[model samples]
Target: MAVADLLALINEVILNWIRLHYFYWANWCGLSTCTTRYLVAMAVADLLALINEVILYWIRLHYFYWSFLAIYPVCSVNDVLRYAATDCSVWFTVAFTFDRFVAICCEKLKTKYCTGKTAAVVLATAGVLFCLKNIPRYFTQKPGTIIDNMPWLCAMVASYYTDPGWVAYDWTDTVLTPLLPFAVILLLNALTVRHIIVASRVRKGLRGESKGENRSDPEMESRRRSMVLLFTISGSFILLWMTVVVDFVYYQITGIGNNLNESQWIFTCVGYLLRNLSCCTNTFIYAVTQSKFREQVKSAVKYPLTSVLRRINKSPS
Candidate 1:
């Protein structure tokens, strides 16, 4: 079910990207110029996430044969998948943040700087950085050990308290994965709100421009609404991630409780659900809050069906 959910999310993202670039040119005015780069980055992230889900599913399904499988498998495949997923997520978050930052801050310079070529370079750089950050994990190895009749496939630096390299990995994942992304998003959202407030105030201060006059500018209003929606989406992301972040910190400081307890399992399940839910929630947010996105969806459905009908009508008897 989790794998299915993740795949569905990937599909949603692909559909949204298609709508933004191919169908809703007027709404996503600058998207076509960078569609190739954006799609490539999204594909990389989606593939990594799918791999992670598959590995996790395998682990869960084969838990009964853990003793046999763990010994036969010299390395923990699931851990490797986890590393890949984290790397992909880092790159995806950075790309999304940078895209938003450029769109908002350099609105006037869009044509010059935010082109497909530039986007491609940026995404490629992010991917390289993500891989470099996580490459150490591949070299780290855990001594084979037996636990509860099951061989534990441990990493040499799994415990950060003892391993300097794992400590660095922990800090990097904590900061780059959630902290930095959330910080940048919060700052951008604050600036957007401030800009809107100042504009509103200026409009009110002017002699001829009344509140009604300011409100009448649909373009300005739409931009403001979009920023608000972006902020809400970012807030939701932060909220969903906070659970996992807290769990990480708790494990780092206090460590997991003794015994393989049911409470621990419940917490783990909840954290996993929250993390995956973040990916799924974005589609709902855009669909519900953004008029442009809703319109894009409408066009995506309508245009394709209309084209198909036309082709059928024009077919030879």
Candidate 2:
């Protein structure tokens, strides 16, 4: 929990900076407006998820139990929002993956589907759907205790574990989130790799690279850049979430109950640790994969100091 708090604090600061950069200086950045919109949405979603899920819920419950956020109604509402924020973050990544897949593999559809207007519409629609989907979570929570007739600390309703409807909802929710996104991302990446390989071979032949003529294909180069960003972000997501996926499958298969043994507890904790870690990794991925993004960061960092210096020079010292 301490590790999670530290990481969440660092992530909060960095994501806020990244969000500001992407939001205000978006036009000046080299990425397409469509891609820029997705990245900005991702940063916001990640920030909300870290704040609500980790700091507000986990850290506050453990370290600052007296806070009013632990009270009934508010705690339940926070849980719903936390789930929605997390859903938005996961699905937004999947949406961006699909967008890139269209841009790279479906040349005929890319122009229309990969525009800023389409991106906005798609993101807004997904955001609304996920928010609605998580509303039922509010009812599944009961108070951990009642103090002076006031309920405190949200806990799962007793029936949630045994009720058929709630069980189905839990399964559906899990499947809808990391599980479905996991499978979809992997499938899309596989198809993308196959397409790129075939296209490269055909283009190479057309360019006479097969005839001992060495030439640079600008089209392939462009595709390569797009692929780098897509794969790095998606790949990092998959790697980080692998433990959580495996942990889910194991518990389901074994039919484990709440009384987990020590080993099971450790495994679950590690899975959650990695899951939280995923929320912080995309910014670093962008820094490592995109040179233009690095340049934008540098420019954003300089803007503050430059403005202060310019003002100081204008004043009589």
For model 1, residues 1-317, the per-residue Cα lDDT tens digits are 75477569866865666555344332453334564355445544544554455444445445633433244243455555566665565446556555655665567886676687887777778777776666566556554676666656554544544567666766877788777887877777777677667766765576467546633666467566657556666777788888877777777677553333787667867876786666556545544565666777788889989999999999998
TM-scores across all candidates? 0.68, 0.85
> lDDT per prediction?
0.61, 0.86
**How many residue pairs collide in each prediction?**
0, 0
Best by lDDT: 2
Candidate 2 lDDT tens digits, 1-317: 76577658867886776667586537555678899888888777877788888887889978988787788898899899899998998999999999999999998999999999999999999999999999999999988999999999888888887889998998999899899998999999999999999999999877668666768888988899889999999998999889988988887888775668999999988987787778888756755567666777788999999999999999997
List candidate 2 segments past 4 Å from native. 1-19, 23-25, 211-214, 294-317
User: Which has the greatest TM-score?
Assistant: 2
